[model samples]
Target: MNMPVLTSLRRRFAALAVLIASLPGAADAQADPAATFTALRAVDQRMATIAYRLTTANAPLCRGLVPVPGWAVHSLGQYDPAMRDQARTSFGFEAPIAVEAVVAGAPAARAGVVANDSILAVNGQPLRGAPGAKADSNARDAAQAVIARQPAAAALRVELVRGGARRTVAIAAPAGCPGSFEVLLGPGMDASADGSIVQIAVRFFERYTDDQVAVVVAHELAHNILRHRARLDAAKVSRGLLAEVGRNGRLFRQTETEADLLGMHLLRNAGYDPQLAVAFWRDHGGDVDGGLFRSRTHPSSKARAQAIADEIARIPAGSPRPYLPPLLATRDTPLQ
Candidate 1:
């Protein structure tokens, strides 16, 4: 049985508050709670679908794995106190926890879980939450913990309350690369991975096509898969102001290059054109270069596009699924 990554799973669901508040129209959330909730759910669904495709496709290459149910859950208590009543009215949250989104064709969707289904219990254990708790994720995390403990590919019984009636369904969870995919509600056009989750700003979705956005997702996922955060820590690389100069700068650039190459392979594995990595840099590189892609720490956009092109050329035609690239060999080695 494939073990679940509980820590990552917990972190993913714990960010519900920020996720809800960051979406567009959230500024007027109190005025039109339904619009804000719908916006959040829509972004959640898109991110989940993209992540599922990449994580499941590249599971074999990842050292950490989790059983992805293809559904995200949220708690009414996780919203701001002032928004609780609106959330209740819009989402019909009769309980603390409820299904937030289900990716199309994912395990949860096949098992019959739908959006806003109130989660009553999992594996016969009832979900519990503190009374009158506002902006808390304790109950939501508890529910996720229960599900993450189950063996991968095993049938997990989930009790749901829909339309005032309760029914149980068994979700056969599938093993996938462990990490939550989320869209941070904001106007910034940036993406980051904290080892446990991949969060992209909402502006990317508003501006770019899904295919172009996947290029960014694959790059961030490559960082997690390569363990770049832990490796940089192990090497004692400085992340402060000095990070953009001297040895610190060189090491950071190395990680960026590795992520670029490996990210292309990830894109290919997921049936996305690796060339889009180059396209993304060509099309939007200037937009981010002044911000996150500062030359001191990252290659120039023109240089980045060229680098991806070179990597794509290196991959032999019709090789195999999960095409193992050269940089992956150094993943466990120390960064120098």
Candidate 2:
């Protein structure tokens, strides 16, 4: 995507965060910094867990892959300046970045990398945090890029500070589907995947069970796995007012249908119940019929549930890992 378009999407993500802070009880949470941080971590941890399962389980089906350390990092600089001090105290952010959450039984957990360990460097290269936080990601992105460059099977040496003691650990970063999963702190019940990132609103965590939320995550991940954004860009599809009309609308709907179908397989591969896709759509689809989830560029909720149910019925019993659906063949084909 072009810089301008990417910037616009990022702005939307930031807006979601602001919207969350304005909701009921949000003010009270913000008043208590510790409570706010705790709640944020809970949401982030859930997203990390779900993303790890889906990405690692279906890595073979992805066109682009990256080493997943089974842990997520956060920078104190990413928080608002008003909350920076509290964040530093809460998370022990001794460096620019720190391990925010680690998936149990994953590479990072196996390596003894725990949450609150401040990451000083990766592979001997220092990571400097940005000053005057307005949610900058330079340090976080740089660290991830360095790790992604490592050999698929090699261990990643990380320098971190734990309990004020600096130590290094070698994490056997395993390959997984590309893109980072993030929780957008907001009340909006929305989710989206830009070619390189999958973001779900915090409301999903607040309202739905992890299994139901996983249904949405799998759908977004499928979009990235199929390169839907890039394909739409390649086809020169209009993303503005024209996006919901004519050929642009048809193409967008096609991608959504593809994601919905493949998403069922992804859910199954990740050991999640594919039936939740139908349940989730039936329960909350009407609530999201406006805004980004408008029917113009997406099929109706009833149609989506039926299609998912149909696809689930088609999958053979006891399908193997990384189930290859027929739709995978068209992922690389130029969009119409």
Candidate 3:
């Protein structure tokens, strides 16, 4: 994207204001999410074509052409750390299985799904390997196609093998929260005030453990350094103007990718092992249902993870760690 000369003028004034951020809201009451999403998506997709035609056909006439998310703005609304805790699973296991604990405050617990129940199926789909990596690509494709057809609250038929006997139960999935840790009877990392204070709730780190927790923190912190909220605001204004003028321009589709790259750089510089970002996603992001890039808020899980890997490779993998503390006074003396 071309940096506007005006942006340079604004940079000095925007610096003090640049450090804050906020939690973005959802679609307005008048807007239907499904339809609004569709229309907005169409404009984004055709941005380049519209801009090119306008500039080529008549450039001088369309000068003030940049109007961002006037009034309001939007981007890929990532439901990461928030939703990890609220996801649900149904069906009983057909055999004895090692229960991987349970998600707190979910339908499973409400429906009396005890740990080690050994789920067998969800409305007939077996839990032994349902809707996950265990299921092959074709199985995954077929499962997604079939499951999407079911209502959000459709009854889940659960079959389980417990104590060497078959049992049946029914459960339903529920709406999720913004961060995964909320469902775990605890708090999690949060970024707000437009990126000023990155609060982390790491009290019960066992469940998320090791690099997973660190990666989440690193990602949130990355948002601050990248000034994503402000950048997105600027991009939206410029793009929205292009859309309103009925022109197609090269859309800012790469913003999310750019954030991933720059965010990774910041995280690695802050001393986090970049490779652990990959493992963190693998642990929780295989079946993400959130947006990626302009289509959504954050980059796709694959892209974010890859960005981290790519960034780490640019530096010495095992370089000395960087510290965040303010530099100490040189006058302070050590025992000699």
Candidate 4:
């Protein structure tokens, strides 16, 4: 979870429009088009699963704040013809927003909303009012707009199609977390938190397995939980060369350490293997360039992996308990 200091150094030269960037392909010849589409579908399926697990498991910690439904969907148009056909063949219907995955025990899950369900309407309202021009945003915004408008602890009437049958299901929204998870377009296995939302890059989904992806995600989610970005600003940590020297370095390392520990618990609570944290760092830590062996900004990969392992050992056996983040010590506008 200790990001390379070199990446930080590079950003010092430019305006820090983005908060954090952490380090972390082959085409088949003449294969069945469906086979290729299946791989993409599998990736999306994993994203949905992890997003739901993390959001719902951490819901209680963010309770009293409004929370979005613990589920993910995508526009049918996002897929190409072959992929669309593959989806129709696999899920029975592909129209409007298609349910990719539903978190176990979340409001959507409790209402019997399962994967492959084509969402037709929300509260009897047709899927409309996409806020953005992009196809993906159009689909996502439409669904979120409905959820965002609901009163606290209000129920949602979702009409969807399963096995070619139309049905209406009622979901009671949890009074949980405030932010939602988003998958961003781009390359690299990077992710970030701006105190409000967790953005995972598409390349990450294309790069790591679901378990590995979960570890990285848990790390970013931990940032939001700890409200690290906001805290750093409140402390007025310098962002220039002074920060690179030691001022901001110390603060960042401190937050990174906290994020790693809380991230493991987040993973465990979400039913993921917290041990993967150790394994992931051990496997990829050396791949990153430019951090001191005993750097003030970040623990060396070896030390970090050890720290993660030690924390994992400290956890007692049983169901993982939620780790509630303290309310903001000082509220500030979230940075991008």
Off by over 4 Å in 2: 1-31, 291-293
- TM-score of decoy 1: 0.87
Off by over 4 Å in 1: 1-31, 131-138, 291-295
Candidate 1 per-residue lDDT over residues 24-110, each given as its tens digit = 545665565577778878777877888888988998888756788888787776666666776777777877888889989998999
User: Model 3, residue 65: displacement in angstroms?
Assistant: 37
Worst 10 residues of 2 by lDDT: 1-10
How do the residues 1-336 of candidate 4 rate in per-residue lDDT, one tens digit apiece?
A: 222221212112121122112211114412443443344445555666686677667776553365456676666544433345554665445456777667667778888888789888877777743222222245555566666666657787888987678999888866555565655543344467777667666566655678888887887777886778777888787665565466578777777777777777788777787788888777765443233433355556777788888887776665446644332232233322
Residues 1-336, candidate 2: write the lDDT tens digits. Answer: 111223222213244346347333345564565766666666677888998899888888886577888988877767666667777887888887888888889989998999899998878888776645366666677777777776666788989898889999999888788888777554556678888878776777767789988988998888888889888989999887787899999999899889989998899888888898998787777765563457588888888889999998888887687789888999889988
Q: Candidates 2 and 3: which is better by TM-score?
A: 2
At residue 301, candidate 4 shows an lDDT of 71
User: What is the TM-score of each predicted model, taking all chains together?
Assistant: 0.87, 0.90, 0.31, 0.67
Q: Which whole-number lDDT from 0 to 100 does residue 267 have in model 2? A: 90
Q: Local distance difference test, per candidate?
A: 0.77, 0.77, 0.34, 0.62
Q: Give the Å error, residue 199, model 1.
A: 1.2
Instruction: Tell me which residue pairs clash in candidate 4.
Output: none
Specify the highest-TM-score model's number.
Answer: 2
Local lDDT at 75 for model 3: 9
Worst 10 residues of 4 by lDDT: 10-19
- Model 4: lDDT equals 0.62
Q: Tell me how far the alpha carbon of residue 132 in candidate 2 is from the true structure, in angstroms, after superposition.
A: 3.6
